[model samples]
Target: MSTYTVTSFASASPAFTETTYEVPRELPAFHVFVDILACGVCYTDLYRFDAVPGSICGHETVGTIKDVGPNVNHLKIGDIVGFGYLRSSCLDCHQCTSGCDIMCKERKLFSHGPGGFAHAVVWDSRFVYKIPSSLEPKYAAPLMCAGATVFAALYNNNVSPTARIGVIGIGGLGHLALQFCRAWGCQVVALSGSLSKKNEALSFGAHEFLNTKELTTETVKAQPKFDFILNTTTGDLPWDLYLSLLNPNGILCLVGFQEKPLEMKSNHFLYHQARVVGFLVASRGVSKKMLEFAARHNIKPMIEEYPMTAKGAANAMQNVRDGKVRYRAVLIVPQDSSKL
Candidate 1:
């Protein structure tokens, strides 16, 4: 009954374009229709665009159920839910059957097509998750992707409560990682390029701060601290010195997507017997658990919000790519989007 446009990112100048499309009153038996209240702008949305030009690009979405299919029994009208990177995954895959749907080989991503840039999204019910009633939609939007990614890194690794943890690069992921580590009872240290976020990181419960700009490789090599070092920055780093900062048998977890391939001496990992590992996003259950934990702990992203119109979204994406957004950028769709 509602008519709205599906916004798409393209190869043309100005980048974002729109097309008017009507929402069918009845959804497919396997789908759930969502009234999108907010959608988060992510770096992946911009990085992966060449693969799906002219397709809708948002993946972090929070909304209410507007309509439900006949087969959807668990969710009902007016329920609040969130959608992340996964659009739909084959339910019968080994990964799906093994309680690792996020790793499903047959999973289709929402990186393209029918993305909810407008008022609503009709999507696979399996990928959607209910949000805590008290969580704000705009704040909850990033929880679907950015928050889940770091929370998975911390949760899946079984970081000890007494461990000394260091979070590198106090940007989108590091900011949240510091808080999660602190709340998990670890003594958190933030390593960043400048002291700009020192006070903020302390306010977020970090116990110590290290400005990487001031610490030389020799200084860090002499300092055998931190049980775990989480590298959350996007650029190449002094990976060797970081490995040196770890204690014996310590783990260095990489969650950032860097442009250049990094290099480090095998001795750093061999002599001390340290580990270098990577983490992906979490399973649906973990995602929900993370949100619940965030809600309970009052952990939230520092975000700058933009309206859902084309121009607003365009400016937000530019700021994100430019690294001008404070911590995160969220696109706030109108409460009643049908009017636009």
Candidate 2:
């Protein structure tokens, strides 16, 4: 059988190492081979570094389809596509049938094989979405993961345009939340521990900016309550304090992952009938809709580019770890990779 060599950055050693895998010519039904052009470096990648050693770890992938299986009629060669955190899920489950594939018990991640950190990837076409022509590949990469996350929270929760939305942590996910909420005609409040990103947050569509570090109980009481508060930071925040800021029946949604167990008074939510929910990445249908909505509204993440090399990948990871990236980091593949 014919085979192709795929080069990727693997975490086999302390840092990333150059590795190659041989992919067979024959693809499974409903699968496609994608030539990765760009991939976004997410904070989740950092968390997975130590957990899955010797694995390729990138999910926010953007590329063009190079080959397709016989059953893949919707996607063809030369079509620009993107893959998020998920590769596929068992279609027989209730969650999958209800359009909540991300919640499926048997869902597969793109990181299972040669991920987007490589020059190419093969994924189930059901989860791979087409990129809109208006959006650049590098810009669309972040949307595959980060954008899908925040958008799913709002869309799935039935957040209305008239709702008062508060976004905590103006980083990768938080930044996109601001733009999406604002474009949806909601009143957006940007909440952060510092004012370092005040101006940028405003430009991204926040109607108000609050420095949480300086927020006193009295000051918090004076502010208006929010209908929905989305927390996108990994930091262990003052949960009770944020819960107090919610309006009656308001929702506190968490999209960030932290190791520590969340602690908060039950009475705080009980008294106000408030609800707390943890959101994973977007479902297949929601992910596809998010791309279309982002393209139509021109919502883009502020990103810094790095070359798709072992050295570049290491540098980008360090920057993300140190909280140095402006908003998001994207790795760009060289155009001459055909020679590889």
Candidate 3:
């Protein structure tokens, strides 16, 4: 095994730098070292750097396993795999045993544990998933996190192909949700704050594009109510407007967390029997199912790739923070074979 390894970190308040770190020559049971091919940069990574120092950040990663432990049978060396936000979960927990490992009380994020920013990482084999042969590694990385999260949220809500789905926030998550909803035979509406996203939304299979700023209770009431509205924004909406857009028994799923509380008129919900729910990245079980579903449907993220070197981390992080990334930013690590 090679003794040299590389890692990226927040060099200053908001900056990152690449530096070499040490690599273990062997593996322990339930552990495997993977040579990372791509690491996706998401908004949550920024939240970690807000008050801390020297935090290793990155969870969405796709790569090849270099070594495996004797106890691990489901995976083997040289297998192309991907791991999401979590690295460890207590198997005995209700959530884990029930296939909801994302909610396990003992869940530990790789960012908070040993993350995927390094050239090689030691991960629990149970948390790693083999990539579908049909998907490219670079595009598959973000799907492990963003893609899985949205897919799980919809699945958890029991969204059917006949459901009328509206996706709010046309950024990374919204784009993927639009495609998934469309592929499932649902009529999708892209709800955005800017008029600029109208064309982009339509191109992504949204049957309708409505500017949130221009929408009001009366205006929305005139249109057919959506069976489900997936809110992926960082701020609260005029809840009355969203609640009004729902048909009887419709749901509003909050996938994005805002700093402020959402304001709503209780009467609107009480009269319509509307419900509000929230979700995060799914458990390992759901992630696996989502991947299988995606593979069958040919649903994939629109990715912008970068190298795993210092320069690549900087460019991708900046694009993510500025919301300039087209959809998702995936960092590619040159394989050792590439160096040859």
Candidate 4:
């Protein structure tokens, strides 16, 4: 059997080092070998989650199938595919039988090894998705994770045209949230700490922009209160303050993590009859729907692109770490390989 060469970046505590691996030609029956075309760098790849030493950390991977196992009949070689953080789950669990296997306790993450940071990777056929050929490859990367995340926040919650939607942060996830909310026909309000993004947010389809620095209770009350506020901010925020902006029975969907716990007064949610709920990335089912929705609405994320070399991956990481990225950061595989 021939050995295949793959380039990968391994986390060595304070840093990432590029390394190459050689694997046997044989792969497990449920798996498929994918030649990666692009990978999106997410905050979770750098700060949120931990991966073992010498393992690749990327989860939003777009590629074309290079090989399929005997047990996998749903996919074939040369198929354009995208895979997210979910690697595998025990199919016998109740959640699996209920067709909501993303919530399975035995769910596995692709970050453990063979992540999309490499030129080639392997994943379970069940969790992989076929991307529309019409979609640009780089856009497909972030759609697998970030796009699916915010879309799920809106989709699962039953956000509607009449619902006033407020998006916080206006960065990686929030920007996409704003666009999706607008396309969904909801009146969108972009909330931020400063006014720097007001124009961009408006250009992205927000009907109104709220600069928190200049915000007042009277100003908030003057506008339509939010029926759904999607908080995509990644740090400690004035949770109670945002809660006050919600209409009665409104939902504040928390999709980002905070290092510190959020504290709120009892009456903050009680008096308004508001709810605070959070969600992880979507199930494979919802992800498919999000892809279709994005295509129909032309809801592509604003992204910064880099080459797919080791240096390129490192640059993407640095850009995300320094908060210099405009929006999503994607690493584009070289042309010779993307054609495959």
Candidate 5:
């Protein structure tokens, strides 16, 4: 019986601990083994730190295929690919058949096993996408999650090219949202509490930057109405004021995770016909399209890199917790396959 050992960083009580797992040589049909090259650290990872002790957590992963199982003709050894939040979904479900696999009840998430924070992982090949040759592994890591998410909001909503879009928060997700909306030919407005992000937001392609801290309800209502608004921050904000800034029949999409239940006035829905909708990462098809769109448009996340060591993971997590990571943080695994 041939077997191999996989090294991973598992979540501990206060930090991450090195752990190892043994796997059989034979993979299940339709699966592929990926030797991870880079993984992006996300706020979602921080949220799950203590949720399951000893569990590996990382969803934005980019790697090279090391092996492929029976029926896996689309991917081969040495092919560079990426995996996002979805692990696998039963293909027979209605949602899966319609290409919304993310909504399938039997969907297995990266949290189900040793995730991207590992030397390698075996996953259903259908959920993995080949990274475009133009995208470097490190730069492509964040796209698996952050980029896919914001892109889905636009793509799924059928946001028009002439739509006036507003992106709340200028962090990891918001930065990417700005670029995507601009590339799609929308009028992009960046909303952030701090004016310090104005220059960076504009550079990312926002047509205007509004400091939310300086705006009153009346002031927000007086500003030009947006056809769509994407909230990408976890912090609770004045939802009613945001709703007031939307044009009639506009959509306010929430992509951030907030612990508190949302509260907003009913007038927006009644009078303006405003819609509030939320979605998980993205369906597999949308994720693939997002990567291709990003590559063609030269959209990339600004990231800080750290080595994939126990100490390095701790430092990166701390930076994310302290709200210091400018845009995104990526963990670069050493390239030696022998060590892996």
Candidate 6:
């Protein structure tokens, strides 16, 4: 048996608790032995905690491969691997076959099994990815989820080098989206409700910053109509205002999941032939593409590291849920585990 740290949901008042779990000596299909070095807590993890009780919730993972099952030939012991929110999918599905496992009918998410928050994650090799030695594991964790999602959205939407892109909100997903957009050669505009984020947004590579509360149609008219807008805020946006900011055939893609339904004007879309699209992460096929793109551009998430054993781990989850983390929060497993 192996003892590991695990976060689980309680049936009563205390929703989340840290506990020790023992794993039997049997192996699951396609399971890889991963000594988790870092695990990034995402907003999605909070959603899982709220929606599913007793779930192991984390997705952004970075670790060293300790073992690979019999059928797994691509990965070996001592290989550095990373995984995003998705754990498994049915390859025979239409969405999976079309290079869109994000839309797979039987997609298995991280909450369904042993997630990144644990000391070791026994995951399917198909969901595992090799990481470069040059990139730090803590910094690379969020890219597996946040970076990959935004990168895939931008690339899948055909964002051009000359495209004017707007990244809404300066939180976790938005921060990384800003960097990806700027590095993609697109003119990036940071749109947020607070003026305080202006300087920080500029530091993250935004060419211009707009306070959405102070925004007017004149301000929208002054700048070039956006080719695309990446709405990364956890809440709903004023859809009419966002749609009006777009040019003909301009697209506004949403990556965040808001609690309530969003309202919008249908006439706005019809007038400009604009689109409001939503994308999750990428397929197993395109994840490599996303990582390679980040590797080439040096795009990575700004992460704050915490220890897995620290009392702050639970607080970090609440911080992410409350929108207090500067960008990303990663839980660092004990360094000695790296040798196990």
For candidate 3, give the lDDT of residue 136.
86
Candidate 1's clash total is 0
What TM-score would you give candidate 3 relative to the actual structure?
A: 0.94
Q: Which 10 consecutive positions of candidate 1 have the poorest summed lDDT? A: 4-13
Deviating ranges (above 4 Å) for candidate 2? 12-14
Candidate 6, residues 172-283: lDDT per residue as tens digits? 8888898888888999999998788889899999999988997776666776678899998777667888888998999989988877888988886788899989888877
Q: Candidate 4 has which clashing residue pairs, if any?
A: none
lDDT of 5 at 250: 99
Q: How far is candidate 5 from the true structure (C-alpha RMSD, Å)?
A: 1.0
TM-score versus the correct structure, for each prediction: 0.93, 0.98, 0.94, 0.94, 0.98, 0.92
Candidate 2 lDDT tens digits, 1-340: 8887888998754579888898776888899988999999999898777678888989999999988988999999999999989988998899999998888999887766668888888889988999999999999999999999999999989999999999999999999999999999999999997688999999999999989997676778988999999999988987888998999999999999967888989987779999999898999899989999999999999999999988888888889889999899999999888613
lDDT of 1 by residue, 231-272 (tens): 888888878888888999899998888789879899977799
What would the per-residue lDDT of candidate 4 be over residues 245-310, giving only the tens digit for each residue? 889999999998878987987796678888999988988888888888888888888999988776
Candidates, ranked, lDDT: 5, 2, 4, 3, 1, 6
Q: Each candidate: what lDDT?
A: 0.81, 0.90, 0.82, 0.84, 0.91, 0.80
lDDT of 6: 0.80
Best model per lDDT: 5
Show where candidate 4 strays beyond 4 Å: 13-15, 48-53, 337-340
Q: How close is candidate 4 to the true structure, as a TM-score?
A: 0.94
The RMSD of every model to the true structure, in order and in angstroms, is: 2.2, 1.1, 2.1, 2.1, 1.0, 2.5
Candidate 6 residues lying further than 4 Å off, grouped into runs, are 1-16, 24-26, 337-340
Q: Compose the digit string of candidate 5's lDDT tens values, residues 217-271.
A: 7787579999999999998888999999999999999999988989999999999
Where is the poorest 10-residue window by lDDT in model 4? 47-56
* lDDT comparison, 3 vs 6, better candidate: 3
In model 2, pairs of residues that clash are none
